[model samples]
Target: MRRLGSALLAVSMFAGCGGLETEPSPESLTSPSFESQQAPITTTDVDVAPECKGIITFVNTATFQTLDAYLPSNVVTNLVNRRATAPFTSLADVSSVSLVGETRLKQLEQGARARGAINSTCVGIFDGLALSTSDAAAIVSLVNTIDDSELHDVLPDAWNGAANLLNLRPFTSAQAISNVAGIGEVSFRNIRNAATLSRPFEALAAAVNAIPSNGSAGVQLKRHFDWWNEVTAQHGYSQGGPTCFGLEPSSVPYGATIRPYLANSAEVMAEVQSTLDYVDADTKISPNVIAAGMANLSARTQGRSFKGCIFSYADDPWSRHNVAIFVDTVNGFSVFSETWWAE
Candidate 1:
């Protein structure tokens, strides 16, 4: 779990599962299924080029744009920005180390493989690191050259699609729209599970270190982690006060940096059924009204992410869950109800 060079560590060891947490909100539990999740694959031969030791994968914006030599790198921004904090330190730091014994990790792995068949919403697999499409393509191209294999052959197609969907930024009215259509939010869990994103981006570290000091990758990496820490720890809801503020912190200068880590339209559709559980009770009105209530609760509690999951109309109960509710550039909003999604 050590942070090597500019690359943040991405490995997962038995972080104490603080007792089966609590049931997801009623909206999240409508499906009535608790299939298992898979554990990530572990590898020792990550393979870093000796010549690429000084190369930095992330650039430090404070240093890069301002020409400051003392600032930390930007890679930390990416990690902290996404609200991914260390759930556990060394395996021994867990409150109940016995719960995460060898048997648990094995069970988690099997559960992950089995849950792969279900719809994306039903599967919450996050390895903690995600890549935009441009970034994915960049990595794919790198893999093809260094590992000599197709990215899909090594990673899932969903992963690729998610990546492309992530870097889809705002352009003028007359810009190209290829993968932008039907794009929703990319699941944070999926990106975290990438074979290349294994805990502790050591390979990436070696690569960055191989590059010259002039290379900005190291600085970029520092920003990414710092941002990630801020976002994950930030409150998801904002109160109306003298000044407007976001519930989450921003590591990346712009909100657009993390927009892709959301549920896409397809994934949003899949979650409609379960999202009902998070709705506020007072909003209830009809058949499957529970779902509607869940959505409402998710919208209010989970913040704007769920707001994107708006239904076609507000009155009809089923209609409420029919259409995906999205706002602006953000996608799937239901996942923001962390209280509902927890075990």
Candidate 2:
């Protein structure tokens, strides 16, 4: 096994003499590029309380008579006059009306609950398990269409995630929702379960049976690669080697073939070692190469803590290449490592 310093030096020397081909600019392995890609995904800073279904209708759409059911006559009259100018935009606005306060708000909430307009459970998650597929689908639908304020009120801890979802609106699949920052498996599951209790989400849920599962591992790996390519292009790094290889995208030889495979951490480690041994046998490369590669990979990954995949590719048969992509399914933290041998 070689130290990273020596391995990197060897790679550079070999590359300069045309004796080996490897990823360029190992320092680029840091996550700045990935972080930069997040800029366009969240464009909003507005923060307002969400409007629950029953509360929204009560304040913005209910008749005077309907208002009378939940409030004193004087308060109803006040609310009616207020609505004549403009419909309330949020629960806070409703609360601000003359003669309405915490007690009145509670009345409204209770009334809505009694009439099936809202569910108490919608405000929080009580279950620890993942939501059912239908439940998850319902939440995804709500997240896709709900305004940022509403989402904020519904999922208070997910303010940043909600903003991201707003920019990446109309999420057609669960995987897309899960990929958003600040939304992890637990949060998603909570949202799903909580959404099942809300009238609006329930209505939408009726039409959706399940949120689409992220495709197989191979599909996900390809998606990650495609995302990297897109990001590199957008950031004006298209002329550089592939980011997966810690180099600009342009470093990938034209027509180089990439094949992705689903693998456990153990499988990925095994393949890495095998590739290193094969290369060493063929070219007598540095004894530390395998150690350096393994160290690089381990440092970048979370071992069994996340899902992993392997991509094997070659610009030509004489060269061996592998990239391991790891995704923290819980939080959507994705990272990759590239190891290659070239003649």
Candidate 3:
């Protein structure tokens, strides 16, 4: 088995030969070229007891008759701005509104659970990723035990390998919610059925929609791989990414790219794989033509496909973040994506 380091060394040498005319830093790369529309992210933390009295119920939290005094004024205003006439079905829907992220949603959940009469409001949804047994069990128990909240047969099917995903925390991103190791098409259908059963939880459907099914290409593939050839992806997606690698792009290919490392090892691998892909795609280019990319050894080694990497990090949500797109032979994804913390 060739170590990951050997692959990195192979790719690094390719990058050194005039890959970039300019290097990107956090500052330079702040405005992302390929991200979705921009929204302000403000984190507001609210503490609530498990049981308490609150005015707005989470199941239909959009119509908070009286905003909690505890909620920051800006948050209340933000909610009001997003809500039109219909009451909010769940916190997840509220999150769809601009500027509402995980922090504000949690604050609302905590307060609503304490004060509102509706107890079945779902706080989080899981896609089909791994989960620890206990966490999986907790969700399973919630589904089975709830009256209209019945997850019933759905949870068990999704729980096939709950033990593997426990520490992974796959629920964090839209792309992360997949049936990779835990849930499957059956479980997904089960959940969808439960939602249609006129369950008490209005949020279940939205959470269900978050998962990808029907043999859809994985969601994160676009972020890292679309621009796998940073040389082309650097131009921006709307501008048209490279359709072909030209068998072998030049040794000192003009417009070929050498990007600064994005943030962590997980991100670097995406770029590495992109580089390797270009080399492998063209008969003229040899693996020996690759180079060390990004900042350091850890950054370059992150893309080693020998590790059996299968996915890339969920594209960073914050618009200020940077992305590196390059090509490689095998797909490179990160195991630590579950543990990645935004600085």
Query: TM-scores, in order shown?
Result: 0.18, 0.26, 0.24
Residue 78 accuracy (lDDT) in model 2 = 81
Give me the overall lDDT of model 3: 0.31
Q: Where does the lowest 10-residue lDDT sum fall in candidate 1?
A: 52-61
User: Whole-model Cα lDDT per candidate?
Assistant: 0.25, 0.42, 0.31
Error of 3 at 235 (Å): 54
lDDT of 3 by residue, 1-343 (tens): 0111111101011121121222222232122331121111101111111111121223233333334444667766666655434444333445666655655655654554444331332233333111222233433433333321012212443444333334354353322434446655345334333322222112221222243433412112121111222332233332222222212332222333322222344544454444334323223322232221122324323444222122223334421212332222222221211111233
lDDT string for model 1 (1-343, tens) is 1000012323322222222222122232223332122123222222111111111111101113221122223422332232133333221222123334333322332332232322222221112212223323333333223211112222223434434443543322111212244322223222222323322333322232333332211111110121222232323222211111221332122222233243343443344333333342224324344343334333323333221211121222221212222221222112211111111
TM-score of 2: 0.26
Candidate 2 has its poorest 10 consecutive residues by lDDT at 3-12
Model 2 residue 260 CA deviation (Å) reads 30
Give residue 157's lDDT in candidate 3 (0 to 100).
Answer: 35
Q: Sort the predicted structures by TM-score, highest score first.
A: 2, 3, 1
Highest TM-score model number: 2
Candidate 1's displacement at residue 171, Å, is: 34
